[model samples]
Target: MRTTDFDYFLPEECIAQRPAKPRDSSRLLVFNRDDDHVEHRIFHQLPDYLNANDVLVLNETRVIPARLKAQKIPGGGRAEVLLLHRLGDMTWEVMVGGGGLKPGKKLQIINGPQAQIREDLGGPRRVIVFSEAITPMLDRLGEMPLPPYIHTPLEENSEYQTTFARHPGSAAAPTAGLHFTPNTIAAIEDKGVRIAKITLHVGLDTFVPVREDDPNKHPIHSEWCHVPLDVVQAIKTAKEAGGKVVAAGTTTVRALETAAHTSSHQNIPEFEGPTSLYILPGFDFRVVDAMLTNFHLPRSTLLMMVSAFASKEQILQLYKMATIEGYRFYSFGDAMLIL
Candidate 1:
């Protein structure tokens, strides 16, 4: 299908500039295909739709302060770098800004470390090798890398993170996980539902606009993900007990579904690798039974994936209702539970 097939009109005011005061206070829109039901509730009400036999899978990948500023050596020009992925102990694939920053050049972070451009990865990306392990200096030099569309400054660094974020590696947050709170998670567990964790470091490609007319022609970027053997076992146990597997976000769904792509043990595989799985409409969903996701941007790969999970027509209809009801949109926005 065409990329424009997923396009819709989202008002500027619908975009949330900051996170909800209390994370769990965010709104939730529930869509159930079983009875064509659509319900409005608070984010904490996530457990109301699931049963004791269900498993809520979440992405534990934490967002790093990947955005950095550097001074060009000799030239002393200002250069900005947004670290995308780590390649080695002191090397990274990054998006560089500031004109005349060709390969084989050098730059130094003020009161921090220095780096040399190894090669051009094209499209604003460059392979850069640092003089020292910049991890220790991150807290001092790095800022929370908020989305470009969000004009407001984040009052706290922890505001963009999920309560359960454990591993630090992502350029972006697994937004669906953002709405979750410790209390809400406890509520789900109290109801006898199991919670499992997977790691998929979100990439900047998530915010990239789909320029292709044909959705299939768009090349999806490979993001590092790891689904442990225990997660596989948890899903197996849940299914054997007649429970549903509900994913917290699209990233969680991608990690779970990609791991199941080459199953050797009863349709479940223990996966640890980078995945470029572009989930389009008609794609077979083997693992995730339901999903808790945020309202997505128009013509985005995320929108396409959710469209495949729930019917595109139904999603469009519910989205219209959401817009009319003044529901927030995007990363810091409200959520939708598709069951």
Candidate 2:
């Protein structure tokens, strides 16, 4: 489909600058694909829509402190480095901001190690070699790589992390999981809904828009993901019992579907490694039957994915309703549960 088909108007004021006071206190928009019915509800009431036989899949990828402040070694000019992926013990694929960050240029990370640009990957991206492994020093040297749209600083770094977050690798938070709290998780479990965790280390590419007029021609980047054997067994049991596979976010959906796609048999196998799966309209969804996700940006891949799950027209309509009804949008915004 044409990328322009996914475009919509989002008022600047509708964008949420910060998260809700209590995570579960955020709004949830429920949509039933079976009958095209819509309901407005609180995020904590999610269990009400789930069945005992359903398996809720969550992406447990944690957000890393990927943003770093640096200075040019000799000129002392300021620069910003955003870590996208680790290439080796002391090298990373990164996006740099500021001028003259060419290959061979050295940088001094503020209060951290020295780094040198080793290769150019076009545009703002560069391969950087650090004096030492920067992963160990991220806590002290890096800042939370919050989306550029979020102008206000977070009160606490934990606000950008999900309660289920365990593995540290993602450059961005899985916004859907950001709405869950301990109490919310307990409530869902109390309702007899079994929870399973998978991981898809989210990247800044998730926020990148499809520049191609034809979305099919867009070169979607691969992200490291893992669907463990236990998760596969959980899905098997849930499906065998006639329950739906409820994915917590698009990332989980990707991991599960990628696993299913890679399998030679009927059931999904344990899958690990980089997945370049791109879900568009007309994609055959073999794993995820339902999904809970946050509002996405206009023309963004996230929006396109949800549209593929539901429909382009219906998703746009719900987004408009949410906008008119004052539901927040973006990373710290409200959630949408499609069933």
Candidate 3:
């Protein structure tokens, strides 16, 4: 399919700048395939629609304060570095911004640890080695990197992070996970809806647009992910019980789908790897029965994945309706539940 097929018109005003006051207060748009109907509701009402036998899988991969400030050594000039992922101890794959950051350049990353550019990996990315492990100093030296479209600074950096964020790795937040609060989790659990956590360290795969016109020709970057044995068993139990295996976000869906890639023979998939699985329309999904996700950018892989879950035409119509109904869009925006 053409990338344009997934494109839509969205006004700049619709992009949400701030998160909802109470995380769970965001709006929710429910699309039910069974009834071919759409229902608009508040996010807190999420539990009311789910059953005790259902399993809700969430991405617990935490958002790290990855954006770092630095200066070129010898003669100083402003520089910036955004950590993508660690290559190894004291070494990271990062994007050194402000131009002129060439291989062998020494970058004095203030307040954290000293970082030296070792190699230019192209795509404006670099291989940088730090003087020490940077993890300990992230809280002191790093800042939350918001999307470029969101020009306004958030009141609290933690607002961009999910309540269940535990393993710090992602450069960007698994945005759909940002809508859930501790109270929402409690409500879902109170209904006997089983909750499982998987990790998929979100990466630049989110920021890179599918530039190729032919969507099939677009390359998808790999992201680290892990689905535990327990989670796999829970999903099997839900499927056997005729309960839905609901994914909390697209990352969760991707992680589960990666595991389920070879599940035609196995009852469940127990997987851990750097998954580059790209879901497009007509791709058969082995696991994910339902999903709760935020509205995505047009012509993005995200939009394509959702279209694969629902129909491309149906999702496009739903997006048009959402725009007409004045629903917020993108990360820190509202949500959509496909069931």
Listed in order, each prediction's TM-score against the native is 0.98, 0.99, 0.98
Q: Candidate 3, residues 243-339: lDDT per residue as tens digits? A: 9999998999999999988567657679998999999999888889999999999999999999999999999999999999999999988999999
lDDT of 1 by residue, 162-279 (tens): 9999999999999999988899999999999999999999999999879989989998989999999889988998999999999999999999999988675556889999999889
Candidate 3 residues lying further than 4 Å off, grouped into runs, are none
Model 2 C-alpha lDDT per residue in residues 35-126, reported as the tens digit of each score: 99999999999999998999999999999999999999898999999999999999999999999999999999999999999999999999
Q: How far is candidate 3 from the true structure (C-alpha RMSD, Å)?
A: 1.0
Candidate 2 matches the true fold with a TM-score of 0.99
Which one wins on lDDT?
Answer: 2
Two-way lDDT contest, 1 vs 2, winner: 2
Poorly placed runs, candidate 2 (over 4 Å): none
- When summed lDDT is taken over every stretch of 10 residues in candidate 2, the lowest stretch is 261-270
**Candidates' C-alpha lDDT:** 0.91, 0.95, 0.91
Q: What lDDT is reached at residue 139 by model 2?
A: 87
Model 1: how far residue 54 lies from native, Å: 0.7
Better of 2 and 3 by lDDT: 2
